[model samples]
Target: MLTIKGKLGIEDFYRIIFKEEAILINKDVLTTVENSFNFLSQFSQNKIIYGVNTGFGPMAQYKINDSDRIQLQYNLIRSHASGTGNLIPEQYVKAAMLARLNTLSLGHSGVHISVIELMTSLINKNITPVIFEHGGVGASGDLVQLAHIALVLIGEGEVFYKGERRPTEEVFKLENLKPITITLREGLALINGTSVMTGIGLINTINTRKLLDWMICCSSAINEIVQAYDDHLSLELNQSKKHKGQQQIAKSMRHHLKDSTLTRKREHHLYNGNNEVTIFEEKVQEYYSLRCVPQILGPVLDTLNNVEKILIEEVNSANDNPIVDVEKEHVYHGGNFHGDYVSLEMDKLKLIVTKMSMLAERQLNYLLNPNLNNILPPFVNLGTLGLNFGMQGVQFTATSTTAENQMLSNPMYVHSIPNNNDNQDIVSMGTNAANITKKVIENTFEVLAIETITIVQAIEYLKVQDKISSKTKKMYDDIRNLVPPISDKDVPMYPYVNKVKNFILNFEEEIYACKELN
Candidate 1:
């Protein structure tokens, strides 16, 4: 079980959320939470506290009686639980729940200790709330999406337990779980935060790392397949430019292609007097997609590094309003719930991921088109050229998916529709940005999968499976084990495409490790 301490990070998130490690609350963290709750309870006596005695947002003008204060929280949970669209998957929802748990554990939301304990129970029990993809303007926090999470905390809404959507009450009984009772401001604190967007953004950041690692491997393998010169990925060439992303990508590519017998040295071929002919037969340089991988993907890596840093900090932040300050002895109300940090970062994330997908698509094109490589058969077809269309149909899937990513990459951070009587006049559509970025990331994985299959096909056509580096050769074997090479007949490629996509999505074991770029 992972213990909740002062700060949480991406690796902690991975172990708890993905590895099913139960969480243990720290004594000091819970003490701070209890102190904050007690202080808020005494401080709000006959005092005007937003979301406690007053209505929320535009409705904050009206005051609530002491008796109806409890009901007001319930009302907020039930009324705002109106989320439309598809349910967010279990993993991402759990991530949001963990993010919320960490923030509340910070002892600033004026939430009871039971709130943290109950959230921990729900997480450990794998009882994910039924959250939707649509709701969440990003500013004033993910109100609609988090409202559903809040509803589950009160035992009134449904939860996904044991792979089935069951009523929270039923699952609570089955697991001997008890719902958190509303006291002062549990409802307001639960939903008025950026955990939903931050959680999803954190997960997206993790997946981007994996996708980039595989992308470098694929880029290096393609170079070996084409027998391209090694100088493009050489240390001297990449380090000449000081961008960390470019140097890291080039360094990684060099590691991946180091043992490759097919990759030629430029100094050996061109620098020497071997270039006796006026017009050299061999193509002097590869296409930008092949040669400029370090430059193309370098910025992507650098941007991703920054994105990860921001997301981790956001996850560990008290991103809710009415922050309870034990030292200051005050309940400070402000816009900490604003999601601009996550929104802008997610927008930048999708943009870079789109560029990465474009690079993969171009590399796939170069391998399939014989005119580009001047070596491989049309479409890398090992079977009958005309009848058996090799990788021809799946290419459409990759291309269209990449185009959709280009469209989805448009900034959701900028598109804000003012709702709630314009009380949230300038909103950060952060949750929308996160959800769309998730789509872009998932779409890029599909493109990479198609690119992987195409690269392996190119390897087989050249009969250089044994000639490539151990890193890419193992990668080739991993893919070939899943989907065998195309034979003389044109089989359905959709199923194979999906298999490869899912493979890379969870393929974590790297063939070799490189220096940490960051």
Candidate 2:
């Protein structure tokens, strides 16, 4: 079961979202909810609350008559379900639902218990709402996109039932479920927050963190192949710089390369005494990718770690305006609903992904360039240069993908256009940042895929005299199965590229299982 203490951190949400079982718990939410309810009863006796007793945004000043207040919540949800674009993937929709639930659990929104129970039911039964990926400004709190989620709760929108899209009413009827009736501040609470942006950002953070680990692993693989100097990764050297990420990276690389026989042997002479000892002739220092691995990627890790901290806090927060502070006996209007915090973090993460993509692109270039590649054949071709076109096209693909990532990394937070008639003058656009960050991370995956394939081919060409490291050998065989060795007549390489990406996307466990066998 996924657990939420009042302090919801990014790492926690990430684990819960990725786990297929889909159970979640917010232990402190009930208390927060009670606090909100008490405040509403004591302080909201006569005044019109923006969402609870009056209209939403552009029309907030309009008064909601007592007779129409409850119906207003339902109308608000049904009307706001105007999303029209590509459906958000089931995984992301599920994540949004979870984020919404955690937000409600904070108890400042005055949502009914039945509403929370309904959301929990959808998660437990795997009843996913159909939501689109567009139309959120991240200022009015992902309003339109989240409305789709709210519609499912009230049996008015479409839902994925038994792997097929069906009307929420039918799905609820079939499951003997009833639509949750909105009461008091329920409707406003449901849609007025940053769940959509948070969901995308959380998911991106999860994948990006793992990708960073793999980049380090790949760097270690390169070190083993080149027999590069270990002095660059020394803890003392990284510690003096005081970068936690660099230190952590150095530790991971050292651990991964610790037992490899392919690395430089300090003894200088062969164990059998067959070869004479000689001073090294190659440059003492390696290329940037090899020597600067920790330096370049460490800051990225630190940034991601900080983003995770912010996400967890945001996910657990009560972000709706006019929060009910029961202890204070007041419904306080505030800007807790703003997504500025998430927008900032998401931008930072995008920059981190850009750096990682650039680094991966550089490493792939090194493997393909004959001079810089340390005696590897041009493009690591299996035969004579022209006889096989080799990894030339694949390298081009990497370069293009990295360039695209750099383009997408332009911060979305910096390009704010006022909306809602300038009432929302300074917006977050965090949803845009989250969506673009996801694409950037996806692009990074493709670049890494290209790098992985290139390294596999290079290793195949090497046929190393000493046994290749067991970990690397397993990775080599795995890629070979997905994309068999390229021959002169292999013609186009897209199929091979697609297959490699599929392996990364769908068979992650199998990939890790192979790693374990090593």
Cα lDDT, all candidates: 0.90, 0.79
Q: What's model 1's lDDT at 100? A: 93
Scored by Cα lDDT, where does model 2 land? 0.79
**Top candidate, metric TM-score:** 1
- Tell me each candidate's RMSD, in Å, in order: 1.2, 3.9
Clashes of each: 1, 7
Error of 2 at 116 (Å): 0.6
- Per-residue error for 216 in candidate 2, Å, reads 0.6
For residues 1-518, could you state the per-residue lDDT of candidate 1 as single tens digits?
A: 89999589888998997788999999999998999899999999989999889999999999999989999999999998989999999899999999999999988888878899999988988889998998889788999999999999998789998889889899989988888979999998999999999999989998888888888888888888888998888888888999988988888888877788999988888888864589888999988998998999899999999999999999999999888898999888899999999999999999999998999999999988888899899888989988899988889999999999999999988898898999999999999999999999999999999999988888888888889899988988999999888858889998998899999888767534253655
**What TM-score against the true fold does each predicted structure earn?**
0.98, 0.91
